[model samples]
Target: MTLFEAERVEKVFPGVRALDGVNLSLEPGSVHALLGENGAGKSTLIKVITGLYRPDGGRLLLDGQQVSFGSPHESASAGIGVVHQERNLIPGFTVGENILLQQLPTSRGLVDRTAIRSEAARWLAELDLELDPDLPVTELSVAQAQLVEIAKALSIESRVLLLDEPTASITPSEAERLFRVVGKLKDQGCAVLFVSHKLEEVFEICDTVTVLRDGASVLEGGPLSDLTRDEVVDLMVGRVHEALVLPPRTVDTTAEPLLELSGLSTATGHDGVDLAVRPGEIVGLYGLVGAGRSELAKALLGLDRITAGEVRVRGAAVRIRNVRDALKNHKIGYVSENRKEEGVFLEQSVGRNIAVTVWDRLRAGIGRLPVLRYVPKRAEADLVSDYVEHLGIRIASPAQLAGTLSGGNQQKVSLAKWLAAQTEILIIDEPTVGIDVRTKDAFHTLIWDLAANGLAILLITSDLPEMITLADRVVVMRDHRVRGEVVNSRDYDTMSQRVIRLIHAEPAPAA
Candidate 1:
């Protein structure tokens, strides 16, 4: 039975028609995957469904009865719940309080903490999670926080759940657990809508798929077996995708290794691993969620603890215990995978954000010597402007707030910050995620130019095409270890297949 349906949904923003005549339908007990490129109208549709935006012209039906939602609370009360891509939990609040917020049990008009804690604990226990109900939300890891987000939505007894990029930051084991929970939800007759750019997860869990492109429905189908992955790619971009050309390898460069990790490991997420990158080479690290890709990157950048290994730069081992150490010693730059969290200060002006990274370069005699705090100057603004122009970032002016730019443009800003630093080894994680096709192409071309300038790059991504296109060699990781290595040659496609197999292959028994 059809649980919910939208007809002729249309939404328009300045300079962009976010959605046009987009239709969506979900049935009870079904898991529907919504697939689209970034800016392809997936978020817009979700916003419309959850009352974040009103459709200019459309009809929404619940159980064949037309319904209207005026606000998120109204949608929630009507059995709709959304787990936003960005976890919106308040840091100071306890998990239990966040779960039962605004509707806590009351005793004589006083809040009932005992009841709320007990209820929240019970729900969390169902997921086999060990989070303390009384602990502040800030105490949780990203994965734990994600679980709490789901628990909060589940606490509402919602009939329809919308999960946006749910597994983007989760561990592999956690993602499996989430899949089980989604299955359980379906078994209980709940309609679950999953929106993600990860196609592997979509195929693993979704019952049906709805593809949207350029704010219109391009295809609707059940059982995605009929569509090849390339077909889906073509549909999203409206053209045959051409693979990126990586420059040929040269072994004679005496430029030395810009960055080196000798059995570097983060105690929290990844174990001991070794990596090295040379100037003018792009090293691809490919893995599924929780395979330690991002964690390893963090360790190299000093955002995470090294725990038990040494990081070397220019043939000398350096102790970088923090971001400042990494920055000053190695002159490294990082574009994080979770761009919304660690990428940019959205409320700040683009000029400020870009100039902030290279303030020292433009400052006169340091106001504070050791501390390295300096005010921005005209030279800093000019440097930022050069980067903005080079990256082809689409914004009215550098004075605009970073938050107002589109996802792709925001990504460009994130990359521009690193370029301004003039770092030797640039580490980027999932750089093109949540970006459209045209913007993705532009971003790739810019990165290619950066590599051509003799910058060693470590690119971490789940996008297979990107790995094949951008990397001179690909390293496949599984179960927290490197499984196989592939050298990109004329046989790059065949080698990429081996890399994929290595990524998904089961681990062998420890010797």
Candidate 2:
């Protein structure tokens, strides 16, 4: 039986028709996939269904009865729960409080703490999470927070659940745990709408898929067995898709290292780590969750304290005080993995986001006054336009807010700032976590081109295929320490085997 349905939904924002005649249906006891490129109206449709936005045309139905939700709370009350890609948990709130925030139990007009803890614990155990109910949300890791959000959604006892990019930040094992929870939900007659750019995961668990293209449904409710990956790609892109083929480029191994970490130790538990990235080289850091790949990058950028180590740049030892010093003094730039937070400023204009790194250079002041310095609008505009055109960022206008643009475009804006800063060495963490295949290909090509132009890049990602596609050498990390390094042959079978072996290998004994 159909648990929920959207009939020819339409949503318009100003001049842009965000969604046009889109349709979706969720049947009980099945995982239905919602697939699309970034900005293809998937998020918009989700918002319309969850009551963050109301459809301008058509209507929604719950159990064949027409229904409209004025807000997310109303939707949740009606047994519809949604976990958006961006987390909504409040900082400093306990796990139990966050989970039951929608319907907190009260005693004599005061919040019932005991009831909240027990109720939240019951929901958390449903997903096999061993979390303390009183633990603050801020204390959780990214993956933990993601799972907690799902537990919060499930606490509403939703008959219909919408999960957006749930596995984007999680490790493979964590993802499998989520898949198991999804299996249990389906067995319990729950209808699930799963949204993700990871096609393999979608194919593994989804029964039916709906593909969106430019605010319209190109394919709706098609069985996964009936479609090939290529076919789905075509539906999402509206074209006969071609795989990205990068040109052969050679890196000079004899060249001096642009960035070198010798016996680096960080406060975040990294010990005796040694790594190097020479000019025009792409060195990948590949590992499982909690492997300290991103932590190492943070320490390099001075976000985290480096306890003991020698960081040499171009054969000279230097200490980076912060991201600013790394960018301006050392010509090093880092594109953070948490793009929504540390990357592009969502509320700012695209032009400003791209020009942020070069503001110091673009600024002009009165003849002898540094305090009165201001960025020349003309200069900023020119630079922003240059990178926008070069990076092929699709935006209605430069003034469009970064939040309004799609994930892929926002990422381009994030990387554009680094390039604009003329950074010789770049560290990109999980560059294509939740982006579509076509956009991922474009980004890979861009990275390849940058390296070809003599830019040194330190790439961090858990996607082995992505690592093989781009990195010339792969550095394996385990427990915040370097285990081994693999030279990329670009052959998935051989490279993946070596990487996996290194990941599961026993630790070396101390002398």
Candidate 3:
């Protein structure tokens, strides 16, 4: 029997049919995986189920009984809980308080702190988690906070738990712990709805699978015994393009290194990292989550402090104390991993967002009009228009708000932000993350195009295929150190094995 069901669910927003006639079902005590790219309506479906948004037309049933959830609170009371990708914990509060927030055990008119701690401890112990109930949430690591969120969800005694990309930020060991937790939850007859971009994890943990594409259910029901990864990838992408998208490497191969780091060490994950990239070269950094990939990029770009070693741009030793210094002197640009928070101003117009990085070139002074007084800079505006057209950004005009664009187009705008900055060295962290197959190709094309024009790029990503396809050389990082470097040769198996070893094998200490 179905534990939950949504039939012909529809959600309309302006010109978008966010969800159209989407149908789904969940069975008790089974794990269901929701599969989709960034803007595939999976998020909308989750919101509808959790009562964050009301569907325009649909029938929702819980345990064969017709039901409507007016609020998230109502959904929670009905044993539905969601652990958002972004942890919603209050840092100042203790773990116990965060777990049972607003519902602490209390007498008629008195608080009961002891009982709350005891209960929180019990919840943690259930998952074999070692956490101090009285410890402040702020002190917890990303992995620890994730465990606390899970314990909090289980505390609700939820019948259905929605985990959206729970493993995105955590390490492999932490992910194993979560998988074990999911197993335990299953043993207790709780239904789990898992959403992840990691296909391997989904196949390993989920008993049933549902694939949603463009706000509709395309495929459902999978033990996945006979499916290959390539088959799944094909289904996800739908069609292949015949375009020779990525431009060939055009920068003089004999040129000196554009950016070089020698024994660069930071207090964070980047410890004594050393690397270099020549002009018009794309060097790909690949590793698992927490492999110090993005951290290294940030340090070289001066977004993060480096406690030791030297960073140089074109053989010149530079003191890049902040982002502004990096941009002004080194012409360094960064596309952050967390796009929503660090990449773009979602509410701002496309033109304004693109113009932000190149404001110095556009303005006559720091706060004055352009050289052509009382006249709009038609040439600069035309550059923005050309970029939008080149990237195929789907918007009515440059005046359209960045937030209103699709996930792909928003990514394009983020790229535009940096491209317009006219930076020589570009640091892109997870450029194709959360983007669809079509969009991924477009992004791949854009990155190579930039490199073809003499841009030195440090491409930091977890996606191995992307690294292999786009990089001239691949650098492997493990245990916060550079493991080895290899030239790209379109060899999947050999490359995969080497990457795995780099991630799992112990590294020798630096001399």
Candidate 4:
């Protein structure tokens, strides 16, 4: 039975038809996938279905009855729940409070604290999460927070559930756990809508898939088993995307290292780490979620205090006390993993955000009679326009807010900021997170292009395939310590197995 259906839905925004004649049907006990490239109306359809937006045409039907939801709350009250990609939890609230916020148990006209905690615990346990109910939401890691969000959504016991990029921030094990929970929900006859950029995950979890492209349904609902991955990709992007293969390394390995960390110990628990990236080399730091990959990146960027270690740039020792020092003195750039929080300023224009790092160079005059220093608008515009074109950033205009752009475009802006800074050594953390496959391929090409142009890049990521596809060398880390390093043979199976063994603390098999 069709539990929910969207009939000829149409949504229009200023100067953009976000969704045009989009139709969908969600049957009970099935996971329906919504697949598309970035800015292809997937989000618009989700908003329309979840009551964040009302369709301009057609109607929504639930259990064969016409219904209209005025707001998200109204939809939720009608047994619809959503787990957004971006976390929507109150940081200061406890786990129990956050999970039971919508419908807290009451005793004598008062919020029942014990009952709430117990109920929250049960829900979390159902998802195989063993978190403390009293723990604050802010104290949890990104993966944990995601799990809590899932628990919160599941706590409502809704018949129709919507999960947007649920596994984007989680580790493989955690993602498996989520898949199991989703399976349980499906077994219970719950209708699930799964949206993801990862095609492998979509194939693993979805029963049926609908592909949207350019605000229209290019491929209507069909069993995923009936379609090939290439066909799905073609429908999503309107073109066949070639498989990403790591190009031959052209870096001079004999040259002095651009950035080297020797016996690095950070106050944040990173200990005795050693790594190096020479000019024209892309070194990948491969690790699991808690393997200290991000922490090491922070230590290199001076965002976290390094208790003991020697950081060398071109064989010269330097103390990077802060991010500014790392950028200005050592010529090191960092693209943070948490792009939404640490990367581009969301409210600022795309041009301004890209030009921010080069403000000193943008100044027209320095050391003048009155010490006049003014930003040359023409020069800034030229530079921003060059990067915008070179990086293929999709934006209406340079004056548009960075937040208004799609995920892939925002990431390009972040890269443009560092490129404008002209840093010699770049530390990019999870550059492709939340980006579509086509954009990911473009980024991989761009990274190699930058490396070919003699830029040293330290790529920090939890994605093994991405590591193999771009890095010349892979440094495996586990528990804040460097396990081992391997040269990429471009063989995914061998490289992944070695990395997995190292991550699991298994001794490398005798050669």
Candidate 5:
């Protein structure tokens, strides 16, 4: 019997039918893969399953019995746990507190701190995670935070578990740990619904798959052994998601560097980080999860203290006080890898997120009172619509909440905000972490076009394939220091081998 099932489920939003007769079944003691491209109703289906949104039609069966959930808490109480693609941890709370937030222990009507720590620690140890229970959620790295969320779900002791892009921010080594946890969960007869864009991982761990395209199921609960990767891809995107298209463009090596880092030592342990990006150049910062690539970017933006060395912008030594100073004064913008937290405002409307950077320019001043200015609604909508069209962001309206969009669409909006700023220098970290194959390709092309148009780009990505496709030069960083640089040949095997050698302390060919 199916542990849980979405039978002919349909969900509708304003001007969009997010789910149309979508069918999925999760079986006890099996890992089921839910496959779909971005904006293909994957997140929407998960929302419906977890009761973040109620279905417009169809039945949700738990243990072969029809049931309904009015809220996420209700679903959890009914023995379902979920780790959403977007983060759900609250800042300023300890990891232990966040883990047991839904079912906090009480003694004499007060929260039991000791029970929370012991229970949270048990769940963390179950997954082989070594995080301290007392550590604040704000202090955890992206991967650590992701693991904590997983631990939170596991703490529910639910019969069904849903993980949506759980490994997107984590390294392969960490992902292996998650896979092990999934294996144990399956052994315990917990129905696991795994959703990810990484097809290799899905093929490796999943026994059965359900492929969704355009809000409908093309393949429902089929055995993975019967379907090749190509077949799965075709089902997810209908023959349009494979190619990584990049136009040829030559960078002018003679031009002065727009953004240069000279002997850059930071409080975050980055030392002697020398980098340069000239006009129309894509300089890729390639590294492992904790190699300080994101830290280097943060130091450049003045988020971390620059204890030593200089960050030079266009030949002049400068000290960037904050992101605002970096963008408004120096015409530099950064698209953070943690998009849900730092990229776009979740609760705000899509239009507001896209028009944020140019709000100053969009504002109109009253007669002789330049200081008193407000943004006109018409101008903001037109500006947001242009970006939404250019980026191919699928939204019913600009007024829709950004949190409601899929992960890939949210990522596009993040990049669009920087583009709206018209920054000469851009730092994009993990441009397509949770995005699907086709959307990832389109994003790569977009980044390429930006470089071709004379914008200096500093890209930090753990994705080797993406680095090979987009970066003109790949600078390898290991343990917070530059190991070597490779002039990208765009050859996958060759580039992968060179980067692996550099990461492993082997000498690399000159750029």
Candidate 6:
């Protein structure tokens, strides 16, 4: 039976027709996969279906009866739940409070704390998540917080569940757990709408597939078994996406290393780390969560204090006291994994954010005069305009807020900021997280382009395929230390096995 349907939906923004006559159907007991490129109108269609934006035309039908949702609350009340890509939780609230925010148990006109804890625990247990109900939301990791969002959605007991990029930030093991829960929900005849850029995940869990392109439904309601991955890609992109083949490195390894860490120790637990990136080289740091990949990146950027070891930039030892020092003194920059938190200033204009790193250069002044040191707005805009076009960033205008752009475009802006900084050594952590496949391809190309132009890159990622695809040398980290390094031959199986063995091997006994 058709549990829900969007009939001839049309939605438009100021200058863009986000959705044009898009149609979708959700059947009970099936997971429907929505596949598209970054700007293919997938998000807009979801928004229309969930009542975040009422369709400018057509209507939504629930159980064969046409209905309209004025707001998200109305949609939720009508058995629709959404786990958005960006986390939606109150950090000040405890896990229990976040899980049952709408309908908390009450006692004598007051909140029932014990009942709330018990109820929240029950829901979390359903998803096999082991979390303290009393812990503040801020204390949870990105993956854990995503699980809490799922638990919160499940608490609604919605017949129609919408999961957007659910596995983007999670580990393979954690993703398997989520799939098991999704299977359970399918068994219970829930209508699940799954949106993801991970084609493997879609093929693994979804029963039906729908492809959207150019704000229109290009393909609809086909059994997953009937379509090939190549077919889906072609449909979404309107052309065959040639497999990305990274060109041979032009790096001169004998040259002085642009950035090197010798006997590095950080307060966050990484110790005795030894790594180096020469000009035009790409070094991959591959590890699982808690293996200290991000912590090491932080230490490199001086976000964390380094107690031991020496950091050398361009053959000269230096102390990176903070991010400013790393950028200004050492000519090094970092692209944070947590884009929303540390990468982009969401409330600021894209031009402003991109030009921020080059403000000193943009200043038209002599020394020591505050008024004379003012930023030249025209020069900054010209610089930003070039990058916006160079990076293919899709923004209505440079004045548009960074937050208003799509995930892929926002990531491009983040990259643009570092590019504007003109830092010779760049540390990029999880650069493709939450982005689409096409955008990932673009980013990979850009990274290679940067390296080909003699900019050294240090890439930290949990994704094995990405590590193998881009890195010249993969540094395996386990238990907060470098276990070994493998040369990438572009052979996925061999490289992955070697890396996996290093990741799981027991640490050597202290010498």
Clashing pairs in 5: none
Task: Give the TM-score comparing model 6 with the true structure, all chains together.
Answer: 0.92
Q: Candidate 2 overall Cα lDDT vs. reference?
A: 0.91
* lDDT by residue (tens digit), candidate 4, 419-458: 9999999999888877899999999999998999999999
Each prediction's TM-score against the native?
Answer: 0.76, 0.94, 0.81, 0.94, 0.92, 0.92
Local error of candidate 1 at residue 294 (angstroms): 5.0
Error of 2 at 234 (Å): 0.8
Cα lDDT tens digits, model 2, 1-511, are 7899999999998667889999999999999999999989998999999999989998999999999999999999999998888778998799999999999999999999999999999988877778999999976766678888998998887999999988887777778888998899999999999999999999999999999999999998999999999999989998878978899999999999999999999999999999999999999998887788988998998888999989999999999999999998999999988778889999999999999998988999988988999999999999999999999898888898998888888889999999999999999998987798899999999999999999999999877889999999999999999999999999999898888889999554466
3 or 5, greater by TM-score? 5
Per-residue alpha-carbon lDDT of candidate 5 for residues 112-181, written as tens digits (9 for 90 to 100): 9999899999999987888889999987767678889999999998899999999888767778888998
- Candidate 4 — what's its lDDT? 0.87
Candidate 1 — which residues are off by over 4 angstroms? 56-59, 100-135, 171-173, 219-227, 243-247, 250-255, 261-276, 281-311, 316-329, 359-400, 432-452, 459-511
Model 1 TM-score, all chains together: 0.76
Error of 2 at 455 (Å): 1.4
The reply for model 4, stretches above 4 Å from the true place, is: 106-113, 365-372
Identify the runs in model 6 with alpha carbons over 4 angstroms from their true place: 126-128, 366-369, 506-511
Worst 10 residues of 4 by lDDT: 364-373
Model 2 spans with C-alpha error above 4 angstroms: 105-132, 506-511
* 187: Cα error in model 2, Å: 1.4
> Which model is ahead, 2 or 3, in terms of lDDT?
2
Candidate 1 per-residue lDDT over residues 21-92, each given as its tens digit: 988889889899888776678878888888989999888999899988888888898899888776779888
Please tell me which predicted candidate would have the highest TM-score against the true structure. Answer: 2
lDDT at 429, model 1:
87
* Displacement of the residue 67 alpha carbon in candidate 2, Å: 1.7
